[model samples]
Target: MRIRPTSARGGLPPAAASAESPAALSGPDGRRLPASPRRRRPDLAALAVLLILGGTAATITLMLNGSARVSAIRITRQVTAGQPLSRAGMEEVRIAGTGIDYLPWSQHASYAQRLALVTLLPGTLLTTQMTATASEGITPGKARVGLALKPGQSPAELRAGQRVQIISLPRQDPGDRTTTVLAQSALVDAVSDPGTHGPPRLVNVIVDAALSPRIAAYASNGQIVLAYLPAAH
Candidate 1:
């Protein structure tokens, strides 16, 4: 007997036979699979440009907000009614969203020589409503008078623009022991601090011109006392 080699079914080697068959790369439905698509890398330059634009927009928005603020005037120290406005008593501050009602630092000169219309506390925002001219202090038929009051004669909490009554206490004479009211509804114009040597405080009051004589006599004789009145509404 003679030995012979067996031939493949398609007359090709097994490896080459599998390679040429369509079923090797086909799906279960016998459709040929498509080639995989290539992935694309990100554009770094475009991304950097977008980031810079976003940051610039944010910065512009912040700058716009900051520019909306204005420099306004504020009181640095306590100011009494009738006291003259001075630069030392005021300071400039940056305020936002204040509208147009406040006094700005640029307009300080217009109000510097003016007087305060009421008691202004520290840190108060200066406004046109809080100031007035010196001529406003002396109204028609009113005269300002000064009185030197001892410690117990005047109210400890006395301030400018306060309403008070000028009272005349009884004298040392045994024949007359009557207390009289010299003037009523007197407006306090100004008050000075007590002296270091224990002297009496000086208070200036605006009263009716007709009552000036009586108030002067009583004040000079040290028989006058100040009675605090309720604030006018």
Candidate 2:
């Protein structure tokens, strides 16, 4: 028998043994192994932009819903105490940031024919504290009376919502010309111009009901004069 040259372990050639090694067995059909899939990194800049845009959109939506304006009631003309509130004397104005204390325009019907508690100027915002019903103007044991006074009888600065003292001047008799205070701290409800050449102006005031008879008597004789009280009092 003829002896053939072989490798020590498997009786194969060295080149053939190397080709069948474990490294070559890892690939299919003895081809090179494909490179592992590359790991992907997150784009931080793009993610930051997306987050900022989302926050901006949320803020804009909140502003549009919360900052919307509505109509409120405001006086267009002067409103005196004890006078009825009419729609003609007021207007609806669109305003922003209105609070709960403000009166809305839709509630004007309830305030119509209501008496104003104080003197309301033009452009004044109507409020619940500014108005009342006609019966609300009269207090317990008090009555409302009207006085017709000449130009010189009342002070030029006397106006609605003012406090005054009704003084009874002495007649042209032999007694002292000292004046007597008939009523003190009387609330002036309203004042009106005669709108003509020579008539006296009318002033309505609230006083004790017991004094109504005496005040009417003095007013009939034109012996009553008005004295303005200090605002602080």
Candidate 3:
């Protein structure tokens, strides 16, 4: 008798069995329909591409933000009206460009002789219009005058950067007791700290240049008073 090799488990191979009855989708008409395509699996190559794109977008955004900033000048200390700017009182800071007429750090030296048009607090961003370059006064139309006011001349709670009205009290020379308004809208630049039996309170105010000469003369008589004018600035 001749020996012959049979298939494993005495059954048809996988290929021949599958070919006998192929897998297919059945339609409503009892006909075969096409099988759907196999779904694809995610791979590291696609993930790597996504990560690269994200990093590029972040880098571009950082560059655009950095390029939009510019260097400007900042005051390091309090500078009163009519006070000149100094090299040690200024520093450079970076800010987003706003297209305003702000003072640039490179031109800080040019503002040394110029006076502050208004009382500048610390950490202030300097601007071109805040300085008077033409004269020793605070501004083209304003002059800063220091008045030694008596205790009752100004409010005890008066502070700097406040608006006030300058009035002159009548004297005994004539029978006139009328009060005079020297300045309607004056800016208080600086206020001296009070103390016990100390010197008179020295208040610095910026008023019109035309009234400066007369105000300084009248203030020496100790008859001038500072009337608080809120919301006048």
Candidate 4:
């Protein structure tokens, strides 16, 4: 029999014996095996746990904060002041909670019977001020009167929801500066532009029912002039 070179460590060659002396390295198959078992790094394991915990905490926080969402009314179109809330012009939407006493969608029927205190633009969120049911409109004790106005009679910048004071201009004597205040504070429902020709333009204003006749009389003779109210901001 031929004798193979050996080391003091037995079976293993001098090179293998000097590199590793474990029992796993005692056979020829041991040279093909790893010196130690593979294990996951503790740092990577901790990072994975932190990621999972962070995601779970974020989910829980969102669940808690999302509960403040509420169903409220949102205006879908322009609604003039003193006009009833049209069902087609409004809709219900989910939104975050608000501190204002905003009108809820559940009270649609109640506010539908009421009138707006101010002109509401498109996409406006409904509020209590827009849903006042008292006699703050051109109904009950109010009147909607259309006035024919020439240039200089009303401000060109006048628009709906503007509060104005209607005055009857003095007679054309140059010496007569006495102007009669027909309506103290009337709400302008709508006003059309007079354009450049200085032609008569129509203006619809809401006034007390008692003042409608006088206002119409002055308007007929083109003596009606509108003064912007300082009370409106």
What is the overall TM-score of model 4 with all chains considered together?
0.49
Order of candidate numbers by TM-score, starting with the best: 2, 4, 3, 1
Cα error, residue 101 of model 3, in Å, equals 7.9
Clashing pairs in model 4, backbone N/Cα/C closer than 3 A: none
Best by lDDT: 1
- lDDT (10s digit) by residue, model 1, range 1-233: 97443345646666666777875656664674666998775797789899999999999999988998988999877777656677777888998855768898999877775767788888999989898764467778989999998888888888775668899989989899999988867777888877544888899998899999999998998998999985321
Q: Between 2 and 4, whose lDDT is larger? A: 2
lDDT of model 3 at residue 140? 70
Question: Model-by-model lDDT, in order?
Answer: 0.81, 0.79, 0.79, 0.78
lDDT of 2 at 96: 78
lDDT tens digits, residue span 21-44, model 2: 776575465666778999765798
* Model 3 agreement with the true structure over 1-233: per-residue lDDT tens digits: 97554557777765665556435324563464678998776797799899999999999999998998989999887777645667778899999888887798899898865667788887999997788653334557778899998788898788665668999989867998999999987777778967536779999998999999989988999889999874311
Q: Candidate 4, 8: how far from true, in Å? A: 52
Residue 86 CA displacement from its true place in model 3, Å: 24
lDDT of 4 at 51: 100
* Tens-digit lDDT string for candidate 4 (1-233): 98878976577887777677566456688767557977879999999999999999999989877997788888887766655566777789888886777777998766654556778887888888666543345667889999988878888787665668999998878999899999988877767785946678788998999999998987888899999863211
- Candidate whose TM-score is highest: 2
The true-versus-predicted C-alpha distance at residue 41 of model 1, in Å, is 13
Taking all chains together, each candidate's TM-score versus the true structure is 0.45, 0.53, 0.46, 0.49
